[model samples]
Target: MPTTPAQPPVFTQKKLPLLRTEELMLNMGPQHPSTHGVLKVVLELEGERIMKATPVMGFLHRGVEKLAEDGTYHQFIPHTDRLDYVCAMYNNFAYVRAVEKLLDLKVPERSEYLRTIVAEVQRIIGHLFWLGTQALDIGAMTVFFYTFREREFLLDWFDQLCGARLTTSWYRIGGVERDVSQDLIGQLRYFMKEFPPKIDEYNVLLEKNRIWIARTKGIAIISAEDALSFGLSGPTLRGSGVEYDLRKAEPYGAYDQVEWSVPIGVNGDTYDRYWIRIEELKESSKIITQCLDKLPEGPIMADVPQIVAPTKDRVFTNLESMIMQFKFFSVGFPMPKGEIYCGTEAHKGELGFYIVSNGEGKPYRLKIRAPSFIHMGAFDHMSRGYMIADVVTIFGTYDIVMGECDR
Candidate 1:
């Protein structure tokens, strides 16, 4: 009774609310499992929903661009291989394309055909890597092994062409370093025939699996409008139902002659994007088949002897060939003024390079527009109200590699 009387007196004395407002900031990464790379996502959580998210990058920064500023034009080729390490050929192609544009150099017809074959093969490998890892992220185990097995075959082909498996500095400004062997062509033809069935195997494993559908079908959906606005490209953009591809819209590297379909998704969801990439693998195989069938017979390199190094036999036997090699190695060819941005539908998306030349051997300025960086910007918007588990699925769908993002 005494306690009840005291409580009433306290209410008369003035009572205050027990609750207060505060913003809860949570650090999801820099070390978390779901970030995929050295990505740190700072999230603001209000109960089960995320109010805001901030991505902190540069943890994998290697000063690669600045390093290029110091090295010679030819010396920087290996460095470009590291930029988008997954698909080193794409990075090599992009940089050399910019340099070639600067020089106004024409690649031999045979070389152009060869480049197409290699790039499309690389696209297959890159997409396969993405599919395997993405499926694993969503808890599909056997699909990972199947995807990697196919990827290993491509890497073996790469090893056969270039001494190294990855980081092939095979492309030069004027043309390729060497010609493609008949053996390589035979192997590629074999891969083209064998790859489609493997893709079907992966589809059977996870494409319609109940668990996969529940996890990815409607989760982290992005409409086509939002995708284009957010600068999404490659499978990410196509998955959202946009039928735009650099290869189809603005064909490069013998793409104009090759016939293939550009796959589109009905809804901009994870599943659609998955389907888009799977379809792209088929289309890329078609392009490879056409290339092997029509590979021209001629010099793999241009007849510009001064620009390209002479063969080992010529280097030893001919004095003139030796002297030309010395000049080309010591003083690189001069590039023209003005800038050009050449883009290709890379494994990630629209990988473009804007190169400026002040009539110098080295680039005045080289700016790379990586697609993963653009796709990452949409993370906060896509994941605002989703559960913590949805983070992995959404991130996997974007297929961000730190090498490309930091580059």
Candidate 2:
């Protein structure tokens, strides 16, 4: 709990008793360090207590949903990368899986296993970022260095798997761009084997620290009902004890093949949300290692060559293959003129794409159910009655990225 700052006595007439102090309107950031991205929270405060918090958005919006209408389905892969820029793998998986569902395509078992591997890898990677920065927000600075250091290792593995580090359009409409090299698999296997001790180190650093507990134990508590009613998911929902992980509740990819536990919180406080992410890091490692062990030997790309990319020899030699190479990029394939909703459990929450197709090369309507956007909706409700300074902790725990929120 933050101590309220003492206010000077205000005399209206002849040294009379103090009247009500004027409420202060404080804007936290478009540049504040504690913000996840370019987000500004307009807070109405009386002394140190926040009466209202309005999150102003649209700063990073590049009209991604609108832009999707102008391009072919294959052309929109790069757009999903910018939504949750940190965990682009899952975004790629989510969008591609939605298209796959529409196409009624069965991805190869090998591709499913590999997708699950990278998805879990991104889960660990994303939460590691959240753990480090969220702890740093509450004054645990060392965690930032430790977490980002491991993040670099993961990024190197991603770089090897795909060329790009951050905004990787690695996953294709049917499958990935290429097969996972054995070298990359070996690197990931090594990481899965050795990552547990690192998580233990993060726990030892701040799990029981007095200052961390005082700052986060009960700060920004949201009840289960409110969390659900406000459309929260991911750790934010699980923190409130809702067992609603899309992977577990609705299995996709190779999630049904793997065995894991979803960590839940009893208190639904900042600390529980923090601890859940740490536990998820361990669970993610387990899933990745399991996928590595069960990885199948088969084609990485699907059999649908009209939508899937063909071999270079085929593209160079065959006239039909040449036209497919052109049409796949210039104009995409058509669907059955129906609406479908598919989502995957991305790093933030239930990242869904609702696509209404008019049997055209492009979608008639496309909307992204970005968890960052949904979580920000409850900002004012949660921040009410908390000390103004605790707003930093609340914001950190939700892990809002303005790119995703504003998109």
Candidates in order have lDDT scores of 0.81, 0.86
Query: What lDDT does model 1 reach?
Result: 0.81
Top lDDT hit: 2
Pairs that clash in candidate 1: none
1-407, model 1: which lDDT tens digit per residue?
00111010111212247756466888877886555568988878765556787888988888877776655577778988887888998888877777776667788888889999999999999989888988888788888899999999999899889876788888887788778788989988998998899889998998679998888776677778888999999989887768889988987788888788998887677777888888889999999999889888887777766456678898799998888777656665566788888887897899888877777666677778888788889988787777667778888898888888888
Go through the candidates in order and give the C-alpha RMSD of each one to the true structure. 9.9, 4.9
In model 1, the worst 10-residue window by lDDT is 1-10
Q: In candidate 2, how many Å is residue 276 off?
A: 0.7
Candidate 2 C-alpha lDDT tens digits along 1-407: 12222222232333336766678999999898888889999999877788899998888989999999999888889999999998899999999999888888999889899899988889888998888888888788999999999999999988988888898898987778878888888888888778999998888888778998889877777888889999999998888888999999989889999889999887778878887888889888888888899998998888887779767899999999989888877888877788889989987899999998999999888899999999999998888888877999988888888788988
